[model samples]
Target: MSWTRKDLLAMRELEAGEIVLLVDTAASLQEIATRDIKKVPALRGKTVVNLFYESSTRTRTSFEIAGKWLSADVINFSASGSSTSKGESFVDTAKNIAAMSPDVVVVRHSSAGAAALLARELPCSIVNAGDGAHEHPTQALLDLLTIREKKGHFEGLHVAIVGDIAHSRVARSNIHGMRKLGMTVTVAGPPTLIPPFVQELGAKVSYRLEDAIGDVDVIMMLRLQQERMTAGLIPSVREYSRYWGLTLDKLARHARPDVLIMHPGPVNRGVELSPEVADGPYSVILDQVSRGVAVRMGVLLLLAGRKGGDGG
Candidate 1:
């Protein structure tokens, strides 16, 4: 299939074939990391800019590494201490960066459609790092890559995603991607944290963590999104943990022994997951981080073609 889209706005808009292509492309590029030189010239001379409005560690750093490894010129921009601090409008700030003629602009903002807004206005490819609680496309892609690598296939797999669903861009993206690939997704969380009409995305909702985990091939634990929380979503952190948190005892009793445990990171330790479980044998949190670089590399190379194999 041809890759025509100049922007990756959301997983919800991607076809199943498109998602598979991305995963395969990234897999082919994974070998570069093993080379002694650890560099590829596929995207040399192509300019990639990170335009982030919100704070980030993993997403920002991963994209930066991806661009650099592929030999692209990478620039980073954030809202703090920038013109946005002086009351610059979001569009105006983006427009100023657009004037530099980058090949791709990777953006993360607090607004749901922020990446889409930039895609429409900018004359370059846009990769959605994240936008509000809407979606995180690359993160979802990397998760799929890991699962596929581990399980050998996605068909007939059950993935249970647990935690703050109402404001989880990760959960939303995962639901869309997994369902498209024929995996059953059950989103388990407290009622208030589960978004209304989430079933429209083709997920089974359950308020019980045990019920969700009992039949899953993979257990994806989501972080408690405190920053995006509204009032009264949960009675308290302690109470939420007591009910929804993934503990060793819970997993042993409810989930499959080989069930993969995953978290997007900056985990709240004892809150969403126990430290034992997070660093235990089932966890793939670190692999997810490593794969982000390759996934972003694939996205960049696809959108903005290589100068040449040697980056000439």
Candidate 2:
């Protein structure tokens, strides 16, 4: 497989075969993740920097673990705890890190395309963790892995992604992954929050929650980015819940008894999804997090030119 030099800034950059290869490779690597000696010699002596300008717990930690499992030294650079909060530019910051001669730099920032921009300037490989409501390719890959594990395959499955599409990098990534895997995807939310022409990306767009949920194979609930919210996007939590929220009763309308439910980390509880449905039998939210490490391992290995093919 041939991969371009640009970092995987978005799912639009991936082909179907690449997605399958990454997920399959991740499944193989997951077997070794629980072992007493989990480290691999694939990336030995390589340094990988976790440069996160945005806040995170799961994505950052999983990437760090993935780098360690591959036997690469990990350096974490957080904005809040580092010099970045003091008004340093991304390019200068990246150049400083590059001066240290790292093999790969994994970054998450509040601005879209930050990773791609840095990739062009640095000699090292760049992995995008999440970029400002633009894309989270790795997160989407892990979510796809979880869904396929629970539902056998991706072809012809109806997947409904509910909530905050305009502000969710995860939602964009999921749409790309679902379409690549041959699943039918739908973005459901209030018209204000959903992006325009989302259907042009091979997804069916919907404005009603109950209608989109009916008989789908998977239901993906995106986190409402409270930190990114501005005035008028949403009126109030209670009011927003009434219109677009996924209550147990709302989910009941779409029940197939085997319909898989999914969500990304740090849930907003009653705001976007009800607690009952989130922790219920159908939810694969926790599994998504668990599969993250393996998927990340696959990504790192692929980029480092290991056993598997490169993602070009």
Candidate 3:
């Protein structure tokens, strides 16, 4: 199928083939990073704007590098020092940026539907970096690319996503993408952390970490958001670690020998993951970071480059 979407808002809205096309495209672009020049003209003459209402390190930098590597002009926008601090509304800020005629706007906001709102209002393609607890489509796509590279396939593979599910857009996007590609997912966390109706989203729920990881091919640990403590969701970091934190002992005793460990970063050391397990041989956290740039490049090429060129 030809690339037709103007925006990538969520994995739930993508067909399985569309998801596969993105993964394959990312795979093809992985070689660019290996080259010394590390630049391509795929998106030359195109402009990408990163409009972030939230603080970020990984997603923001990854998109910037992706656009630059593809030879597109990239602009970085932050809400803290911008007109947003002077009470400019999101729509107003976005419209002001859109008036400059960017080819793509990659946005991250605390509001859930912010990306969708930009998609409706802006003439440029909108990529959802992170939208409240709604979705992080590129993160999920990179994760899918990483999984396919490591495991050689997606169908019938089982992934256990553990920790802070209710507050994790990464978990939500991964569940939707994985299920569509015939991968089974199990979400494990405290009952309060797990949201209602996740079963309807095609994920099995497990309260215990051991139970969830035992037979799965991949164990994805999510960040334990600090706000969860203030929100009274989990009792304490110490207590949560005792039950949910992944350690070498836990992996040795319960999880499969070939199981892959993954985290979406800014990892809370000794919180959701032990030092040994996080740096262990099974961990592919770093691979996910590298794949992120490739995934963003693929998305930009498809969405922005297609407008004027073959995007190859």
Candidate 4:
């Protein structure tokens, strides 16, 4: 694939072949992170600006490191420090930034269609880091890469995504990407927490944690999204954990002995997952984080690099 798109907005819009290309490109570039120099001249003069309207840890840092490793000039802009907090509209601020000529603008906003709007308005390539509860494409890409590394393939692999599905951008993106890649996805959460018509996304819905964990190939527990909560989704964190949390006991009794445990972190230590299960042998949480950087690097290289440049 020659990579014709100017933006990488959501997994829902990507072809199955495009997804495979991204994973392959990331795997091909993983060696750079291990090398002594750890630098690539791939995007030597390209500039990438990370525009985040919300708070972040992993996603923000990963994009910065990825751009720096690829030798792109990387800048970080957050709402607190930027004109956004001063009542500047997103489009106006973004236009001001674009006038400076960045090669790519990676955005994370609290509005669902922020990235799509930016893609429509900006001349630079847009990468959706996250947009409200809509999608986190790079997170899904790294998750698929990790799963492929562990399971050898995506077809027929049962991935049970547990917790906070209604507000989880990771779950939304993963549902689309995994189904497109031929995996069976089951979203498990409290009835109030699971959105209506989610099954239309080609994923099965489950209300029982016990049922969701049973004999699955992957058990991905999501952090309880407290920040995104507007209504009472659950009575309390303790109650949600009692029903849905992945404990050592739960895994031992119901989950497969070889089932991979994954969490996109800033983990709620005892709420969504227990300490033992999170640090246990089958856990690939750390692998997911490491693969995140590689995945972002591949995305930046693909979207920011000139389509005319050396068969990109």
Stretches of candidate 4 off by over 4 Å are 81-85, 227-230, 309-312
lDDT (10s digit) by residue, model 2, range 130-214: 9888889999999889988988888999999988888888998989888988899989888888888888888888888888888
**Pairs with steric clashes in candidate 2:** 2-312, 3-312
RMSD of 3: 1.5
Best by TM-score: 3
* Candidate 4 Cα deviation (angstroms), residue 188: 0.4
lDDT of 1 by residue, 1-312 (tens): 767788999999999999999999899989888889988777777889999888998899999999998999999998854345579888898898999999899999988999999999998889999998999999999999999999999989999999988888999999999999999999999888889998998999999999999988898998986644447677778888899999999999998998999888879999999999999999999998888888998998888872224342
Which has the higher TM-score value, candidate number 2 or candidate number 4?
4
- Candidate 4 lDDT: 0.91
**Candidate 3 lDDT, tens digit per residue, 68-132?**
99999999998854345579888898999999999999999988988999999999999999999
Instruction: Name the weakest run of 10 consecutive residues (lDDT summed) in model 3.
Output: 303-312
Task: Look at candidate 3 and tell me the lDDT of residue 43.
Answer: 83
Residue-pair clash count for candidate 4: 0
Provide the overall lDDT of each model, using Cα atoms, as 2-decimal numbers: 0.89, 0.84, 0.94, 0.91
| lDDT, residue 34, model 4 | 91
Candidate 1 yields a Cα-based lDDT of 0.89
